[model samples]
Target: MYSRRDERNRHGRDLTFSLLTPEDAFELLAFETAERAWFEQHIEARKEQFYSSHGVSQHIIDCLALNAQGRMSPLLIRHKGVLIGRANLRDIDGENASIGYRLAACACGQGIAQKALKHLMKEARCMYGLETLTAVVSVENQASRRVLEKAGFDAVDKLPDHARVADRRLDCLVYRCVLRQEVECA
Candidate 1:
């Protein structure tokens, strides 16, 4: 379990980061439901079932299982004790992992997501021993692409028609970052 509780002050707002737990189901559900349309603009939409209590509980359970097995680090971003966003490192295989994050529309334009991402990268290096990280963003999501680039990720590839959001088919941009330089062997 990622048992650390971290507090960060951004623009006079208190931001908290921690591992997702079963206790987070209710708040997560509310956050997801409230921001579903906003999120679908850049990412795929969740099934209607995902807004339910049981569905969210199951989602939390599955994520925690992955966390315990060292395959993922699913985190919650809270502001003033409410679920404001999510940042996670997924598919942690060997020395590589992919990152994904989302923030409520109200949280946009404040650099909060970028800050949380940098913190996740720190945990990726120190706690998980990850050396490389990759991220994907919709080509239309200029905001997210900017965040990834601002955090030092380089655009490594592009996929045509990679994802569908609402009624539109969108392309995706793949980004990569090297967390550390590997030592040369004698």
Candidate 2:
């Protein structure tokens, strides 16, 4: 049930975020199809069905179920009324959750990911009542690491052979942000 419209991108376009809904299946499928190759390079492999409309509809339903159970927040990121990305606060455990985000290829290098992440973090604290957020980034993915750092996450550890991507075991850097301090200070 999350929704916000006040955030904006650098280009002065409105940046909106909302909980993923069944109605978003089409746009989600389209975005996934368009960015599949770009995203696959950085993220874990997805099932073949994930790029299809039926798969996306079921995914949305599952996300909504998780949201209803207070286990996850799957948010759709939109810029100027168009889907541009997604931000998720997943695997909620009490006051903590794991954060993940992805931006469309066309939206990369524009600071949109960082901006959207910052907004998502705020929502995670205020709306979701989360106190801490964790993230894991591939060591080879410098851009994503930078985004996490820029969004105020502190690098905490490096795990060897942490992530398996495309038949390769890659190292990963773990990051954590204490949201309670930020919220209290604000």
Candidate 3:
């Protein structure tokens, strides 16, 4: 339900976001290809990436389909028409929303994650009337946690033994960004 008009109200559209649609699948697929390759090389064998045969490619396709059905908003990160990664706002709960993202490993450390998150936050606030957004990061994923912090999400809680990663119970850190605080900053 996020709107470009809300983005205009906060700032200009260029500084905010553009919603993703099913028509953007090809570009999204490109990023997914890169991400899946990176995961297979570095994360899969280590059991860090817990994806099935459906893979990132298929998962992206599914996300796009869901977006088209108004079930989610999955935005691909693009710079000059080149896809770098993807971020999504899902698990909607009335005024609250949950977010998650993945990037090609080569694209990491470039601030794209933070940029995508900032854009999504604005969209959620304006379009969905969302007051709170949350991100769940693996306890050991310092890099992802840092990205969330950079996007103005603060560690709000910790879910102990919340996920099974690589067959081992792992903790999860919950980070939250409240729209009221962001509006105050503006």
By lDDT, the best candidate is 1
Q: Score each candidate by Cα lDDT.
A: 0.87, 0.84, 0.67
Candidate 3 residue-wise lDDT, 1-186, digit = tens: 657546333332233234665465555545555466564432223232324433444665777777766557877665545565667889766688899776667556656666677777877787677889998877888888888887778998999988655556778889998876444223
Candidate 2 Cα lDDT to native? 0.84
User: Which pairs, if any, clash in model 2?
Assistant: none
> Looking at candidate 3, what is the lDDT of residue 34?
48
- Residue 174 in model 3: shift from native, Å? 1.3
Give the runs in model 1 whose Cα sits over 4 Å from its true position. Answer: 1-9, 181-186
As a whole number from 0 to 100, the lDDT of residue 61 in candidate 1 is 94
Residue 19 Cα positional deviation in candidate 3, in Å, after optimal superposition: 4.0
TM-score of model 2 vs. true structure? 0.88
Per-model TM against the reference: 0.90, 0.88, 0.69
Residue-level lDDT tens digits of model 1 in 1-186: 322222224432578888999988888999999999899877999888889999999999999999999999999998778788999999999899999999999888777888888878888888888899999888989998898898889999999999999878899999999986442222
